[model samples]
Target: MSSSVPHAKPGGRAAAGAARAASPSIIVIGVGMKMRGDGGFGAAVIEALRAYPAVVDRVRLAACDGEPARMIDLWQGYRCALVLDAVRGGSERHGFVYRRELDPEVGDFGAQPGGTSHAVGLGAAARLAHVMDRLPGRLILYAVHGRDFRLGAPLSGPVAQAVPELAARIGREVLGALAAAAAGAGKPAKGG
Candidate 1:
């Protein structure tokens, strides 16, 4: 429900690049499964971002089912990548959100649960990308705790409520990256 969504969405590659260089350099990727309960957090957040006017205009957006290769490919050229996904296998309460900026050490990810919906999880994706040198300059992950993953079930109550909240936070991060790119900030992506 933010009133500050940007009015214009940047067009395809050529147009987006010519019109705004930063738009292509920054990518936002949402990963999840819609058919399972609470597995749709990533997609839901992306949907909220799409409806918001400010976000789509300033960056590249992608939705994926947490497939490792596809995930790496989508973020290739971008300098900064903000990835959103559902997480399970942890003690965290449902609807809890964890924000972690992974380090370059591809070996140890500290057990990042990228949800049970995928065969290989997101931490594996990052490691693979690192091995192939496909990682963007900065890769930040926002993981939402999932309560259920039964196929065809709807999102849990807490997860349903968390969708918009996480979306707004991500929207702000996108705009901040846009601003930094615009002002020639040229700052390192410690937390971009």
Candidate 2:
């Protein structure tokens, strides 16, 4: 789990079918800086996800460029929100992926403001949303640890290799969430 991608299942077809089977109510928010080396993890995930046309059609995907305000608006009225971002200086090594829930009760999964300079707005915006009572019911963050954040840089080798697997994980999680929601509402899960 530390060295390789977890949940190594192919999600392209399943995700596409799931998207086509129901209304799109899940939002995946990808936030990153495009030119800042591995800091562009969110954008990479979004780019990778775009390959599934059906999923793209049914799910709301936003490459927020680290703007938490935009993320707030993009996820409004959505059933679930999945956020991706890059962070540095964490216990996780470069290219490490961290997935955690942001329940309304627990606040922010122990995430502090300014975890990464680029992610400052994200933490703050989450607090603002809490204050304004605008948070989605289900919020999760899939954050990747970044090595280089210099301008005009590309993702390092490890980070680049991890993007596809991470994207697949995002798809699976989104589909699962949609399925659970459908089940809770007494409807069959789409594409299950």
Candidate 3:
């Protein structure tokens, strides 16, 4: 991951507060690289989400380059952030969705010499955000097991086929989070 942090104005606090007041609950940052096969999953999910009218007003969609610092910059103003990425976790055959709550204490995943090419890795960005006290209390990572990361125009078979399902799952998760937040706010919850 690159260490170049995208510089945002110091006014992120006010923007965050205003976003919170105007939205249903949280923000979603879809991190992906279109040139890298399955790595484009995040972008695909966002496209799917855009077709859903129910969520258009409640969520903010951002397409990231998978650079850790850039990712952090994108997430700076949300109450909760859900990061979607493609991972070669060796569990693709099991057809499972990999989800993890990233601990801000763990620095960037790409910090290691041979780690992913993502600049500054997601873990590192999360840690930096935490240290800066700018991290959302609830941050979730959804990693879809990927079969290929090769430079290509399309996703590998397994990952490509998983797109619709992944999109639906993300949609459900977002709805659930929103409903829960609403309930906590003493408002009638609408969706599951």
Candidate 4:
């Protein structure tokens, strides 16, 4: 699933159609340091998602260079927040993933703050959100195992492969969240 380029660019028309009105209810954020090898996984996955406009136009998308304050602000008022980043030092091998929900309900946010490759990563942002009472209704993190953070190096093989998979999964997440919200509001989901 991993590669530098998006799987396809044929969705240009669909992507263009995403210019419809209405703010998105969910925000998908990719947090990473683009200059560092696998450390840029978050940003890479975000680029891959450009292939899916149905998902793109339905949600707010952002790429953060691992700034805690900015990250917190991006998800401030959204109903749901999804974070994509790379991590290290887990019992699992390279490319292993950790998915957690940390919000009104804890969904096993068990990974240590130190595991992240970011300098002042989501852990600090989560802490800030906790203190400020600014967490979204739903907050999820998809952290993929990685290494080779050497500057100017491209993504590690494993991390690159995970990009497409994460991109597609995140697309599903955006759409599904919209569907759920529509059902809750008793209306058809926009652009579904």
- Model 3, poorest ten-residue lDDT window? 107-116
**Model 4: residue 137 alpha-carbon error in angstroms:** 0.8
Model 2, span 22-53: residue lDDT tens = 64677787787678888888888888988877
**lDDT of candidates 1 onward, in order:** 0.77, 0.73, 0.67, 0.77
Off by over 4 Å in 1: 1-23, 111-116, 185-192
The TM-score obtained by model 2 is 0.78
| Candidate order, lDDT descending | 1, 4, 2, 3
Per-residue accuracy of model 4 over 97-166 as CA lDDT, tens digit each: 6688874544336555338887777877887787788887788899888878889999989888889988
Model 4 quality (TM-score): 0.81
Instruction: Supply candidate 3's per-residue lDDT for 158.
Output: 71
Q: Which stretches of candidate 3 lie above 4 Å from their native place?
A: 1-24, 89-96, 104-117, 187-192
Backbone N/Cα/C clashes per model:
4, 0, 8, 2
Output the TM-score of candidate 3.
0.76
Give the Å error, residue 94, model 4. 0.4
lDDT for each residue of candidate 3 in 1-72, tens digit (9 for 90 to 100)? 212223446678786567446654466666777778877877777777788776667777677877766776
